[model samples]
Target chain A: MSIEARFRIDRDDFTLDVDLTIPERGVTALFGPSGCGKTTLLRAIAGLEASQNGYLKVGDEIWQDEQKNLLPHQRPIGYVFQEPSLFAHLNVQRNLEYGLKRLRGVTPKVSLKHAVELLGIGHLLERKPHQLSGGEQQRVAIARALAVSPAMLLMDEPLAALDMIRKHEILPYLESLHRELDIPVLYVSHSREEVARLGDNLVLLEAGRVQAMGTVSELFSRLDLALAHGPETETVIKAVVAGYDEEFELSYLDFSGGRFAVAGKRLPLGSAARLQILARDISLTLEHQTKTSILNIFPATVDEMTYEGTAQITVKIKIGSVAVLVRITRKSASELGLQLGQAVYAQVKSVALLS
Target chain B: MFTEYDLAALWITLKLAVITTLILLLIGTPLAWWLARSRWRYKFLFEAVVALPLVLPPTVLGFYLLIALGPHGPIGGLMETLGGSPLAFTFTGLVIGSVFYSMPFVVQPLQGAFTAIGERPLEVAATLGASPIDRFFSVAVPLARPGFLTATVLGFAHTLGEFGVVLMIGGNIPGVTQVLSIAIYDHVEALEYTQAHWISGSLLLLSFLLLMSVYALNRRFSVVKP
Candidate 1:
């Protein structure tokens, strides 16, 4: 199942015309700069905007088509907008129950108790929205959306208004919600850090057009894509838990052609996880070095090179079958004669465990 | 402490106030919502028309109403064609005059309530799977509770105080059309100062309580900042 969306809407000051498709599995983030119609697309899909055109299909159901138009309330979709948008009159529990009660049925896909537990809002049930902290309010908002047992979930920058501390507070809940729930989620954000943290699939948008759409690793490491270059550019690796290294109090994570050792973790074995290696944290060597303090090393092949700045250049390399990006000085790159297809080794100073 | 005439006046007052408020709410809600949200270039013109009764002298309106309900006028002619009474000097005519006279009291509060909502809550409700009517009852009505309270009380109280319009159209018939305001006037005209004091003092107290509750409750609710 996939979401097929095609839209062409004209506004007084701006017009959004684009067509895109999203796979029906994990979090597909509509990532873009602000004012690029990312939020408009989300609203259109939710049936909130009537001036929109084209077909919008989620799985087997067509929310909007030339022949049929489903009203927002008629469609089973959970939307968490940028604002927490908790009903001010209702307490946290009643706010959540508002959607749950509307979704009347015998076979409920999401249970009230389970949603409360998942979002950790069980204790905030009786409190009004204004009484809750920003993070707590957003959590309850998500729980309220989830309680509807919608066929799909659309989150439009749910944490955009929060400060860093509040963002950190809500992110883990979002990550865990993604992991625990099986519904298709389409998230929208322009923050690369947020995309790196929560995105399973990425759809880069700019000026009301799609820039790219692929898995996080696929977009992050591809050679031709501009996303793999410049500041905050990083490599996303899908790793599986191998075993625990008790002596060093670290977990051994195994990927395609290398083993990554990180700070100790308590995850169950064989569970999948992600690793993000910043481009600035990686160094390249022509051959294996013995005196290096860096422990994580993998055989790398230069895939493509692009001059990012006068002093620094971005190098895309293959670690077995996966791609890793390394930014090196122009002088160092020239000394090694780094060209496409040249074999080398990547030395990483550190790697971060992304959920 | 009430005479049988005073009781009839009270019943007339209640009937006028209740019917006036009920009719105003039904006619004013959608108009207020539209006034709150419309983008028409001349929308202010519509607002001025709705508020004309607020500043228009009650006698001035009653004078026009008197002519309009007379058998020779267009409205009375239409009623005659439809096999209905001309409606002047009747309780129904009193209600019509009161509805027009008390319209601003009901519409202004309801409009203020809808405008204060600022569209976000309704948009959120729409996204949360609430139809327009569902959201109106489940969200907008509850959110606008204080405003509704104020509007209803003001409409009722304003109708009870109506004198000029009822005098012109209702003709002050004691049992048929004499409301409390007219009854008070009649008592004072007969040199019954004590009975006048009783009736007038009751109306004054009732109006004062209605306005006091509006201010106090609205103040409290405003500070609560829902």
Candidate 2:
């Protein structure tokens, strides 16, 4: 099942027109800059912004059609705004219970106990919203949304109001939420780091339009998309921890492509983790070299190549089913004679271990 | 040393203020909510109408209310046709006049509070499964508590101090239309300076306390707002 949405909204200064079929199972990051209607689209999906010309369907349920519009409260959705919009009058426990109490019909899919535990907010139940820290309040906000057991979740930059430390603090809970829940999450964020870390499906929006929509890795590797050109350009790989080399302080990650080793922290064996490999760190090789200090070396076939300005070229390389982006200089590209269907070795790079 | 006549007048004045404040809250809340949320181009017209009592002379308001509630007037004529007495110069007529005179005091603060709440909280409530009415009571009302305190106190105190409106519409009748302000006037007109001083002094002290409490509570509430 998927979420089918077609909306056209006109305002005094901007117009948002988008048609999308977002996957219903994983986190779909609405990645964009400010004024891109990311939050507007999220609000529209939750039935908060009433669109005159709109059609929305989540799975088999028709939330909005030509003749009828379900109100925001009528739709089974959980929305987390940028700030922790908790009920100021309520203590943390009551705030969490607010949506759960209003739930109608269907047995609650998410239990209150589970929500409280998932967010790690058991100790804060008695305190008022103002009494808690900003991060703690936002955690309660997330738990409150989950307590409703909604079929879909819409988060409009849930971490935007926090400091760097707080964002880091709350991100693991959000990652766990994405991994633990079966609900589809439409997460709107402008932060590439957030989208890369948590998003499975990415919908890049630019100025009220859908610039590109694909898997996070696929979109990140595309040379045509501006997302691939900047410092944020990085290939995301889903890898399971194969084992640990205790002597060398290295952890072996097993993906479809092959085995890769990284400086080990404390990740349990066989647990899955995400890795972000930047394009600049990757070097193209005509032959695999054994006497190199670089630990990550993978042989792959070039799928496509695009020139970047004058000096460098971005090559999309396919290793098994996973795609990796390598930025090489023009002299290197010409010397290696890199072309479509050419077999090449992508040598060594550090990977950002994101779980 | 307040006599039975003075005590009765005080009781009637309290009754009028309390009833008027209650009725104004019921009427003003929705009207203030609308004024806070509505984007209609003509909303300022309704705002101006609500504020008419603020700027208009109390006697001028009394004049229009007298015409409207008189026997030959539309409201009084309607009551007469329905086999009830005209509302003119009755206790109920005094209440109606007080509600109109004190309306701005109740509505303006409520509107300010609701506007201060902005749309985020209500929108958050809606997404959290609260219906519009539910959001109003469960979220909006509690959030606007300071405004309610201010409005209630202001409405009650302003009605207590009313003079010209009650004089124009509610004729001086002991234990009925004769409120504290009107009774104080009666005492002064008869050269009873001592009785006037007692009533006037009590009113001055009471109004001061109510306004002081409202200010203090509003500041405390604002500081505690989440």
Candidate 3:
């Protein structure tokens, strides 16, 4: 089961035309720059925007088409806006119940208690919306949406309105929601860090068009995509915790690429974790160095290379079945005689454990 | 110091204001909501009609209304065909007149309040499974409470001060069509200065209190976030 959507929306200044088939589970991020039709697509799917010749089907349910157009309230969806728009008249508990009370004949998939616990908003149930801080209000808003137990969750930059501190405050609850819920999520964001940390599938949009669509790793490291040539270019690795070195306080994560040693014992053995590797953090060598301070050294095959500006070059290398990127000066590329399909050693200097 | 005629006029004035306010709210809410949210290009024409009483002289409006509610007019002719008397000189006629006379007072504040709410809250409510009517009562109305209060007070107070419209249509029948303002006008015309002063002073005090309470409650409401 998947979500199939085709939308063409024309405004005075811009047009959004796209056809997409998104997976039914996990977080699929609509990643793009501002005014790139990311929010428009999400709203069209939620039946909030009227698009010309639109077609939308979530799993087996047909929400919109030539003959059928469901209203926003009629569709089984929970949408979290960029602003935490809680009702001023209702307290947190009543706001949460607002949706639940309107769920005509359909059994709620997420109970109010479960939603409150998930967002950690149990203490705020009695307080009105104005009494809560911005972050707390957003959490209550999230809980209020969850209490409806929608078939799919649509989030349009749920953290974009918050400051850095408040964003950090809410990210963990979002992560837990991703982990614990079975509902598919369409997360719209322009932040690369947010996409890397929370997204499983990526739909890259540019100028109201789909630039690329694939897994987060595939789209980030693809040489043909603009994401590979930027300063913030990075790749995400899904790995399992193989073991924990208690004495050294390091956790070994195993992926298709290789085993990564991260300085943390927080993740239990066999649990899944995500690792973020930056292109600037890796260097290419002609031979394996046994006398290096770096703990991770893997034999990689150079698959592709692209020049970055005038002085730097970005190279895509494959370690086992996984892909990684290395940035080197243009001068170093020629001196070392790098070529496609050439086997080399990739030395990593840093890796960020995303989750 | 108040006579039986003065008391009767006071009672009639209060009754007229209360009924007019209640009737205005019942009809004004949907009209204001539509005016605030509709995308029709011709909506301004309707808005201008609703606001006509604000700029037009009260006697002019009353002249047209008196024709409309009289025996020869379409509304009164239809009523007569349905085995009813013409509404020209009845309490119902004053109510209809006041509803028209004070429409802008009730609707403009409501339309402004509804517009200030923006689309986010209603969209949020709809996505959360609220139907159209449900969203109106649950979200829009509560959020626009200050507007409602202002509309109510202004509608009531403006109706209490009606004189020209009632004189044109109601004919100032004491203890029936005569209200406080009409009774004061009669006192002044008859050279009863003391009775006119009493009624005028009471009206000034009542209007002041009504307006003051609206401001106080609206301040309290504004303190709460939308």
Candidate 4:
């Protein structure tokens, strides 16, 4: 399914002008720093904020047009604010039922029973919002939004208000949502780690403007995009289970950069997984070193380079059309005489297995 | 010993306080809600006017209202033309005076409550598909219950203690405009200390009980029951 939106909203201090479109199913993370208008765009889509000119089409349905502004409730969009914001007067059960009752039809996209199970909040149904812990409250909030059977889910920094421990507590439920629900989610977040964990697609926003948009791998591998130039710059590679070495207790993850034998991850055989390799973790060597114990290596060609700090340069290397970043000292570049068209061997120091 | 006039005065006081408190709650509620939420630049003007009676010597307000509701005055003449008698020197006059005198008591508490509620709850209600009015009634009202209780108690007690305004406008008509404050005044005027003590003591007890209940309930409701 395809979603298209072009919106221009003006406020006293903040003016947002964005044009974006996502052409398929997946969790598209709206990633940016604070005050980037991520929440504003989400609000505009939800009809909670009126824009001067906004055109939104989700799947086959037109949700908004400048000529016709649909009210928030009229548009089947579920929004979770930064705060859990459950009705304090209502028990968890009633909070879930609040959205269900709003639906005029007999059939619901998300059944009450299913939502309780999905968020795993059935046990807390009778408890009030204040009675639950922060994570529990957020889960109830998510369940409440899901009960209405929304066409698209708009989550605005749903985890920003939680403590680190609380955020850790609720992340798995979000992972489960991506696995179970096929509904498109527009998730707004400022955390790079969260984006790496959840987003199938990425929209990099900066000061009310779209810096870049593409699949996570595309955005991360594009050497020119600012997203690929910073400390968080990393390539997200989609890999499938090639095989496992039981004796070594390592699993072979096969991707375009060739096979990576990482510590044994419990993922089922043949299940697709996403791996994130940080730019800083990658080191470049001109020759295939036979003495080093570096377990992962791939042959790559130097494509481009950028100076990061006073003494270091970030090199972009391409492997079979796959781009990965490597951080090297200026001394090494001078010693190895690195430049464009130079072939090298890339070594990864560490990799994270994304859920 | 209690005379027919004493009993009549006590009855008038109870009637006036009850009727005035009722009318204030009915009319002041909408006004208070507007004052709480209106973003008009000149909003403080209306707020000043509402608070005038509280600062105005009760006699000054009563004097103006007396002229306004008198048969020869604009309001009284307007009422006569509308097929009603002038309110001057009548039970209706006392009721009007008490409502005016006690308005700030009711309006202030209710306004404070409504303002404290802020826009979050209402916005949440709207997103949940509640219409504007439904949100105000179902969400705003229930959450503002403490304010209502405070307003009711203060309004009733303030009206009960009203004296100068009632006397100026109502003229202390026995069994009609005469209230507990007026009755107590008459008893002391006649040097009947025994009778004055009973009426004044009873009112003191009533106002005290009402205020105590409000504070106690407010304490309980303030914890924000989930």
Of the two candidates 3 and 4, the one with more favorable DockQ, higher being better, is 3
- Report clashes for each candidate as comma-separated counts: 0, 0, 0, 0
lDDT of 3 by residue, B1-226 (tens): 6789999989999999999999999999999999999999999999999999999999999899889889999888888999998999988899999999999999999999999999999999999999999999999999999999999999999999988898898888888889999888889999999999999999999999999999999999999864
Off by over 4 Å in 1: A222-226, B1-7, B38-45, B184-195
True contacts kept of 4: 0.29
* Per-prediction DockQ: 0.62, 0.86, 0.81, 0.43
lDDT of 2 by residue, A136-173 (tens): 99999999999999999889999999999999999999
Top of the candidates by TM-score: 3
* CAPRI-style class, candidate 2: high
Which 10 consecutive positions of candidate 2 chain A have the poorest summed lDDT?
A: A225-234
Q: lDDT for every model?
A: 0.87, 0.92, 0.93, 0.85
Per-candidate TM-score, first chain only? 0.97, 0.95, 0.98, 0.94
Residue range A1-355, candidate 3, lDDT tens digits: 9999999999999999999999998999999989999999999999899998999999998989999999999998999999999998899999999999999999998989999999999999899999998999999999888889999999999999999999999999998899889999999999998999999999999888998899998898999988888898898999998988888888899998789998853786787789998999999999999998898899999999999999999999999989998899999999999999999999999988878
iRMS, model 2 (angstroms): 0.8
Error of 2 at A63 (Å): 0.8
lDDT of 1 by residue, A104-133 (tens): 563568898898999888889989888889
Q: Which model is ahead, 3 or 4, in terms of TM-score?
A: 3
Candidate 3, TM-score of its B chain: 0.98
Q: Model 1, residue B171: displacement in angstroms? A: 2.1
